[model samples]
Target: MDTIPDNIILHPIGVIRNTTKQPFLVASAAGLTMQGDLAPTMDRVRESEETISEVILKGEFTELLEGIDEYSHIKILYWAHGVPAEGRSLKKVHPMGRPDYPL
Candidate 1:
């Protein structure tokens, strides 16, 4: 594997404040399956809806977001805490661990 460069830097601009206690999820068998079958009931519950979440900006950057609510959609990039920048690599993933779907 190639070595990581030292020039990169990342600083958190804001936080995703939500009611989610377990803020981490993956395609682990324990989390996505029951008796080797897809949990259809749970899957619908996990599907996103118009839930409330606040993107509280940092104190210094609060002024930078002056007219953000005018847009219909706002793209937010959340930094996964404790996950490294170079850790992402996925050729294919069975969406929700169902064999029929590979994303």
Candidate 2:
């Protein structure tokens, strides 16, 4: 396999806007932790269902979204900007911080 370069650059095409101010998962000096239960509560699930989110693209990228309405579903790549530089180096993590799940 080819080795990845140490220096890589990325430009944001758009931003995700949501009502949720704080993140559900947080990475601290100790390790990754959740603000709530390992599994989302019923209320949280309902809140997510009710929440409305939008992807605001940059002016240059706005035209790329044309014809997007024709698709029933689309994929989005999210960037975790809140994570500290060290947190990105984690080799493994339990899915949703659930111990039952293999790392």
For candidate 2, lDDT tens digit of each residue in 5-91?
999788888888899886666665555656677446435656777888898998998888899999998898888887898877777
lDDT values, one for every candidate: 0.58, 0.75
List TM-score per model, in order.
0.59, 0.78
Which numbered prediction scores highest in lDDT against the true structure? 2
CA lDDT, candidate 1, residue 65? 84
TM-score of 1: 0.59
Q: In model 1, what is the error at residue 25, expressed in angstroms?
A: 3.8
RMSD of 2: 2.4
